[model samples]
Target: MPVAPKRMPFFEHIAELRKRLIVVVVTVVVLALGLYTWGWQIFDFVLRPVQSALELAGAEKLNILGPFATFTLRFKVATYAAIVVASPIIIWQVMAFFLPALKPKEQRYVVPTFGTMVALFIGGIAFCYIVVAPTAFEWMVAQAGGNSVQVLPDAALWFQAVLLLLFAFGLGFQLPVIVFYLMIFNIVPYNKLRANWRYAYVIIVTTAAIATPDWSPVTMGALAAALIVLYEGSMLLARIVLSRRIGEQKRREAIMAAGGDPDEIDALDA
Candidate 1:
């Protein structure tokens, strides 16, 4: 059999990355144009749930800021839509381009990792839209105490805040996958992570508290608690992966100690 060649040089990898990035950028732009064409309808769809909630709460009106706020809002929604649409393709391109450099076993993990990432990202955004945003909006509105202050919702700012929050939550949810990879590479041992759990818990809570825009203790405290739960969940997953790796390592050692080829042990067991 022909031997596989060594990986490409750093410059070659960079050039490939540049090419892939261009493709992703073009795809996003095309999708954005489509979204812009139907921007108003999409905007209405996005805001419909919040609008209902506001109306139910007896809010007189949802006001937009500045003459251009409407346009900016539509464009912002369209851009975010573009990102949502292009994410899978972008991830696919990246995975395909980088596959040659990864080990066969590691490559097997890619599809599931991508899927988990996509699901987590969508889940985070949905959670923000469904739970956090509405709750925050309601609290803020109630706090206004029927004052005549024009609660003009800036379209651009609203989406910007939502997008950032969504991204933060999504990235936060990737903690498990990250730690699993770290364990796989022996960069962070399971025992070390477990030993530092207390510190990690503190950091997670602090980060969650800071990530929320609301200054209220209620929101910050809730976010912090949620972060702690997620941290523990990630640790649980890391432990599972670490256990599997340890089991494989032991099996290999057993075969070696028995004066048998590790690969042949599988056939013998069969």
Candidate 2:
């Protein structure tokens, strides 16, 4: 038997949140410290795609304008890497803080949904790095007129741009998971999403345009296309889940009407 979660007073809740936040901060800082030791290697890895793009355009390497620029860039890179590395702990802390407030059925969905979100986030980042970054950078390089203009990008700006794009794509890929929960909780109907797909497409395109770091149409279009697919796929899955839930509800209703316990019916069915 599962033990019921204990409810805390408002002040206690605040204290608990503070504790979790402290844990999350400590974890991230520790991870950051570890990453700082290898910050140069990580920076080089992050710079690889841009370097390739620059090479393809026969451009020079990125420039560091200030004395502290490299140090600052490495620190920033380590921080970003730390956040990525500590994401699971951060998420767990967040979930633990809020899980007590959710109903049992809602709680059941949390773990699976969180897992899906993490997988989608990683997939999105991978897509941005492997496909979007290279394509966008190549396009930007091409616009510089093939060695006519010096293509010396600022290292700091380049890192910021890549990190922003990666974060955007990772968060953007959570659309399906968000949609799934909305449908599961009956906050949004699957039919409604299906009906409003045109509006959804506009929203997706606008979001992709806004989220992408560069103004390259190829990158925006790719993100939009991927989001649309995820949205449609989510809708389809939501429909199936909704159908099964409705069927189960109807079956329970029929069982109750026939003077049979729904629990026993479920047990028998199982």
Candidate 3:
């Protein structure tokens, strides 16, 4: 008689998941505390661009909002910073959860995917903080030049808007990485996507327009143009990848066609 295979307890899987969750929670909390200690400095750094914009536009000092607003704002900034700092750990935890189910080749894709996600997010944040935020603020300030519009930036509103824009751009900048990965996975065919390029441009421009809160046509056009360029760049990359794969496939078929014998150089009898 064949012996029955032993079954592992279901709780073992649950325990493993629980352990990862605990690690992520503890790491985030510790980082949050560390960030809180330096929260004021971090907040100041984030606000510097806006501060400079206001100064350049000859606006007066930013009038902060109600009591306890400073403390709350610092806490929010620290929390966001901690989240950013702990992203790798969080990503690892998420990837680990699916580790058992992935094949070897699929497993190889994980680290690169994680890295790409992180890089894209950082790029997006930088784009927002460095390019989009400053330009948009300058434009907004320029709009108020003729009128005696005193800019009293509410601490809460300013920070909120800054965070929103930063995150929006950062997430937006992931387009190329996302599309390339989709192509790699064969989720979307290259020819099909290429054929729909016109529609894609329209959608990309629309997305950029929606993402731009201030509704400046120039800013929207800039962001959309950037995204479209990235889209084309991704397509070029995907083409190289697909071409390589096709060449390998053709070589394999050639070998197979040669009667499964590399030495065979002439037509064989059936």
Candidate 4:
């Protein structure tokens, strides 16, 4: 038998949330400080894709318009790095907060789900860096019409765009996990998701358009295609998993109704 979960009063819940937030904040601050110590190295690593793109476009170097721009950019880089470093802890805190609300079976999925979320986020960032960014940059530069106009990107703007694009891709890749949770929690049925494919496609296209850093159709199309594939794949997996879970639940109910121990039935099967 599963033990009942402890209930907390509203104020206690607020206090727990505050404690978690504090932990997250402290972790981020510490990571940010540590990254700031080596900010230049991180900045270089982050700038590689853009630098390569600029070189391919025949640009020499990015322009720094203001004296304080470099400092600000470095700080931003550190902050972003900090967030990346602290992501696992952040995920843990979120999961911990909601664990009490989940049933035993649902709780079993939390760790795996969190792991999947992290993997998908990293995959999204890698996809953007390895494929999307380079292609988009090359395409955008090609639009300059054969050396008629020189491409001189601002250092701050360039870094900001890269960071935004990375973050966008990372978050966008959570669609499957989100869909899985919705179905698992019965917030949305599999039939409804299957029936609403057309609407989902429209939303995914709009999201891809908005999230992509470049205005080029190539990047947008690539993102949209990836999102659509993830959506369909998630739906298929959800259907299978949910069907199995429902079947098992029905079997357990049948065993209970027959006044037989489900645990004994499981042991006998084993």
Candidate 5:
């Protein structure tokens, strides 16, 4: 007779975690190298918004400041790009590492959630690249003391601001996943979440204020709005995904409320 496989011991679990971490690290590092080789092209795309805003403000190019600025900027860009590109694999490895602890039903949800998370992160970055960065840079340029001041920002700082905002938006885009999982685990119930919109809005605004590196009103407001929409969207998705589970819970509650047979309802709940 074939033997059934036993669960991993504590040390084995630790080893598996270490292995997953290693894979994530190696994937990012390898991707970084490849992206570094194509750094300039990446720049042309990622930096387009800032560059356009600068050009419009009469600055032909960014200030290069010091000898190693270009090298350092390219290196940072490549590393960030690698993280952005390798996000799907990284999220998968991280989620897969914890799969053994989940119930079968829970495990089934993880795969689809993984893809949703990747999409959210990428969407955030793209939104920043295409909209947030461009708008913020243009507004900043316009505020730079009028025509007397040229808007030739330091290359390193420019890249830093742009990258920071991109990452901020990317993470912001994952609000739905966070909300959905909170519901899934009953850490926060669906009805409570829906009922407490004011508090949630406060938290979202505060999170946006902190997460956005610029601390600009524009970026913060944009992220907060996007997150609010995502939060509401998550509620809709949860209702659909957990439709049957939620329906059963409602039925049990109704029986309890109506003073029906508690024993049978309790048995089914358990």
Candidate 6:
């Protein structure tokens, strides 16, 4: 007779998390399968910028290096598309998991923050698709040294590069969401944010350089510039949104400094 396993103290949380994971995986897998069926059609749209760039550069054609490459490309592309298509559900599930941990004040921000995050990610990908993809490919083709060297790009490699840039920019565009939360949650103070602009700029530029698949200065510069704007905008918004919260915290700090009972900091908020 096999005994039943004992549940952990946090078994409910584990179960809830498992449920969310199952939903996300199922959603992605289903979409991936469907997308795989229509891959070339999708790829035609996805590779438009690269296609245009090749034409402008007078490249002969994009070639598949392997007999199995087309199938592999379709599968991979479908998986990426599925992940992207399922992002909203993914974001909602992840945020919902943390909603219970937030105070009522923070709870009100949940919907708007998640919505903004989704929009920003999509916007970032759009920017890359519209701008960086064409620019980077053109630059690359130019490096082939004119009409003497006929540019023949590998289909699999080109598609992979485009995917990397799109996702990198999308992830990069989440900077405001992160900065906004850190300020609102009092994890990082407004003063510190203002003071650390230099360090922030350095990090942003370095991240852009590393994240861009092609190492194109044009792509990196565009991403870095956009991030800098987002950072400043976030700082301004945080100053507005967190003004009252910051004031309350500072008052509580002063009370503690004047020898009030640290345990009674709750009294100060009132």
| Candidate 6: regions farther than 4 A off | 1-8, 147-150, 244-270
Q: Residue-wise lDDT of candidate 3 within 203-244, one digit each (tens)?
A: 999898888776776567767887898899899998998898
Question: Mind sharing the TM-score for model 5?
Answer: 0.85
| Model 3, residue 26: C-alpha shift (Å) | 2.7
Candidate 1 structure quality by residue, lDDT tens digits, 1-270: 111233888887777778788888999999998889888777666665456446645655556778887877788889878988787787677777867778766677778888987776677667666766666656665676666764556556555655666666665655556666786678977788789988877777777777766655645565666566666676788778778767877877788899987567674334
Residue 73 displacement in candidate 2 (angstroms) = 1.4
| All candidates: CA RMSD (Å) | 4.1, 2.7, 6.6, 3.6, 5.0, 6.0
Instruction: Name the runs in model 3 displaced over 4 angstroms.
Output: 1-21, 56-60, 99-101, 145-149, 259-270
Per-prediction TM-score to the true structure, in the order listed: 0.82, 0.92, 0.82, 0.88, 0.85, 0.84
Candidate 2 yields a Cα-based lDDT of: 0.83
Best by TM-score: 2
Over the stretch 164-221, how does candidate 4's per-residue lDDT look in tens digits?
A: 8787888899999988878878899889988998998999999999988775797788
Please give the ranking of all candidate structures by TM-score, highest first, separated by commas. 2, 4, 5, 6, 1, 3
Evaluate candidate 1 by giving its C-alpha RMSD to the native, one decimal: 4.1
Number of the top candidate by lDDT? 6
**What's the alpha carbon RMSD for model 6?**
6.0
Candidate 1 off by > 4 Å: 1-6, 52-61, 65-68, 95-101, 147-150, 215-219, 265-270
The better candidate by lDDT, 1 or 5, is: 5
- Residue 171 error, candidate 6, Å: 0.7
lDDT tens per residue, model 2, 85-153: 887777767777888888766787777876887888899999988888887887877888855576677
What lDDT is reached at residue 247 by model 2? 87
lDDT score, candidate 1, position 113: 81
